[model samples]
Target: MTMKISIERLGPRRMATLAVATLALFNAGCMVGPDYHRPQVRVPATYSELPGWTQAEPNASAPKGNWWTAFNDPLIDELEPLVVVSNQTVRADYANYQEALAEVRAAHASLFPTIGATGSATRERAGSGSVSSAGTLVNSAAARVVNSGSLEGNVSWAPDLWGQVRRTVEENAATAQSSEATLANATLSEQVALATAIIELRTTDANIDLLEKTVDAYQHYLDVVTEQDRAGTIAPSDVITARSQLNTAKSDLIALGVARAQYAHAIAVLVGKNPEELEVAHSAAMPALPSVPVGVPSTLLERRPDIAAAERKMAAQNAAIGVAVSAYYPEISLSGAAGFTQSPLSGLLKIANYVWSLGGSASETLFDGGLRSADVDAAKAAYDATVANYRGTVLGAFQNVEDDLSGLRILAEQADVLDAAVRDADRGAEIAFNEYQAGTVDYTTVATAQATQLSTRQTALNVQESRLLHAASLFGDLGGGWSTDELHDPRHPAAPAAAAAGSVQGGATSAGSGEEKVQ
Candidate 1:
């Protein structure tokens, strides 16, 4: 007597055993690559330019998140949100981050077996044949119809022996993080640009208004000089000078409209509209310059998205080295198939005709004429290049902050002097006009005074506008302390400081190393 075993009796037990075995195998798998470590450069002990500014009380905390609101500009606050939704470059970076996340999932998926199920039915006919029976020769001919069906499945998986799959996943994850930071940087820049442009537009409108009033005043003076010339009280040269002065004032007023138009066009682009579609009323003038909390220099790395992105890029490149090194090792994969078949549909589920197969395969590059070696070398060189770029990015970030701070300081001082100059010129012009009206001064003196006043007022306006622009630059350089903590979420591939490795190189500690600070 023979005993039979059915798949139904053994399948569950075998599956559980295989699952445990697979888990054990993977748990035993060693990740074969050097973990990433961020390189450190020398940071200055203190900023050389912060001497004159009033320092905040020691250990005093500035408000976190939404630092731009400190300016108290309602329009600027309102426009910041539009950058994330409407800026084209930022949208593109967000899409790239999504794609990178999908790639990571795709890589992680390789650790599991791909199972596919299939079914089919078929019909066939068999021809008859001759046969001999007993002592006499006999011919037997018959025809039979047959039907067959099968339910089947196949599975395949690749074991990560040299950490190739893990490294690939790591690379994609880091790239995704970089892309995420890039999006944040783009959004921050757009917000800054839009605010700066609006401030500039308002300033231009103010200047235009000033010039228009100055033109009107000069026209009044021209009329007076014309009347005097008609009455034979003034020379033709005085009339000529008065007309020239009036024309110059009119020209300056006309020139200001050009800048106003350009700024309006920029505003339209920021809101994702055509230049002709959007129009600002230009009612809001520039407010007082915003005060920025210039945090410590080391805090910049935490705040600045670009610096974080550059650092992540280095991590991605480092992972690439692992992927390339993995090429030198053999690739191993496991595959399996199981099915049941029968000549008739009624018997298709029976165990007697069951079929199954299990297999594994390996491949290695025995000789490639130096191709694999070149690939590894190329990966290492790429990593080296990224390290250099990361260093450059840090330096550039510091330089930008310093430059903007210096500009704000210098421009503020210049604005004070220009304001005084405008006041002096205004007084001089009033005196000259009064003397001209009283017939004690020539029309030429009045013309010179009017021109001087217009020039000085315009300079003051330009200087005021420059101060605002420089302030915006300073805030942008500081990353306005944007939060990238969300990106570092393991669920989120774009964690901002995911590449930080928890500390700086050589284990040297800094002031705010443990704090959640972003540039």
Candidate 2:
């Protein structure tokens, strides 16, 4: 699947959240933990099976966006675009990515202060009649009513004093980027699956055509044998054999419809539609085998979406270590309230009735039974785990590329051998038929030759189908023209540390700077 319209589909809230993340990314001071760097993986300089492979030159005039068009099949071209747009799995991954971006914004908000307003009103009887003896009558004359009201505004901030908020924002931004890469990986996988199903369906169509022609040929053979049997020129068993072969061919032809229908249904669901709603047309011609370029192994690091996602996860986990380390530092909080209060709701806005308070405090974990130390150790362990996972992903990507290349090469050679065998088998069957017609050979020789021809032809067709499937798989393993450069960073262009620090004043005043304070 391709995401040409990804940004447009995300609503305004998503866009706004991303903007907040961008800002906070540029507003933080020095983060507490280790900065992120990609872990080293030992990659072979070249693909093992692509020793003589020629590098493809980019053509500005040709379309690189849809590489599957190399197959030159109009049907495939029509369906490939739908994988990113309508595929249910792709859409779900996209939603998950959007949610991750929103989380980044939530994390970004922690860098600012919190402001709130409150208002209240009260009504009561302040005085009552002194007479207990004549309570009811005296209270009516002596009772007094009072009304009071107050309005207040308050602001509180703990500051990102030790970069905890910044590190958290960093972690979430990395996570969001990871989610974006995951979406890309899923879309590509679904697109490849759809292409493969179509290839199988096309192969089924070819198989059915082959069987139909075979059935017709057997029918003709049966008619000739029946005529000869009636005249006592051929054995009655030959007639029975011919009829049985025709019936078997017909049965095989009928069975292919089930597989064809299943493949069509799978393709429909892959593009996000009900099976019954889709109508697949039969095309006897298979898509041509495409030439897939196998680049050097090191390029997979920047070319594969899964590798990018794994790398970003490492970054997120590394930032988590910073978030943990930030715990060791002291936290400072400042709060202020300003308001007016008065009796009887009179002069409530006057200077004497005004009330105000300003306060601040600082706290540090004096002792926690090694809890903070445990947290730091856990975060480091998690980071180490992600590093291993990232390297493992890179290794897996290398394996995918190598496997596709080797399979395609070996399959090509096998396909050549089968094609040659098919040609010889066709000639052999023709010769046997001619000899039998001239009474130089028995009918059994003709039957044997025809069966061999059919077997060889079927095997060749299978190899052709396998080659097409491998071609499609090759495109997917090669990242389907994706690049790590396509991944968006909320803090792209990497702002200088001084510039990031300078933005603190604005972030404090406008967005309010604060994170969860350690108690």
Indicate which candidate wins on lDDT. 2
Steric collisions counted per model:
9, 6
Best candidate (score: TM-score) = 1
lDDT of 1 by residue, 1-519 (tens): 975434355675797686568756863586666679998976665556787544432324443446567667666666555566666666666667657767777876776678899899988876565556655434334666778899999988888877888888888888877877887788778878887887888788888788779888878888988998999987899889988888987888888878888988887677555676656665535657777778567777777888888989999889998888888888888788889988877788887988988787989889999998899889889998999998899899889988888888888888889888989999999999899888898877887788788889878888888878877877788876675573553334444234233211222212122222110
Task: List the candidates' TM-scores in order.
Answer: 0.87, 0.86
Kindly provide the TM-score of model 2 when superposed on the true structure, using C-alpha atoms.
Answer: 0.86
Instruction: Encode model 2's per-residue lDDT on 1-519: one tens digit a residue.
Output: 743324446665995585456445434556788988877889776777877644433534222458789887877888878777678887788778767777887887777768899999999987665656645455567688999999898878777767898899899889988988898889889988988998898899999889888888888888877887888887678787778778888888899999999998898788767776677888888998987666667667877889999999999999999999999999888677879998879888888987877676989989999999999999999999999999998888888878877888898899889888999998998898788767788888988998998889889899899889888887887788877877776544342232233211222211113321110
In model 2, the runs with Cα more than 4 Å from the true position are 1-28, 52-63, 137-142, 491-519
lDDT for 217 in candidate 2 is 84
| Inter-residue clash pairs, candidate 2 | 1-187, 111-513, 112-512, 112-513, 113-512, 113-513
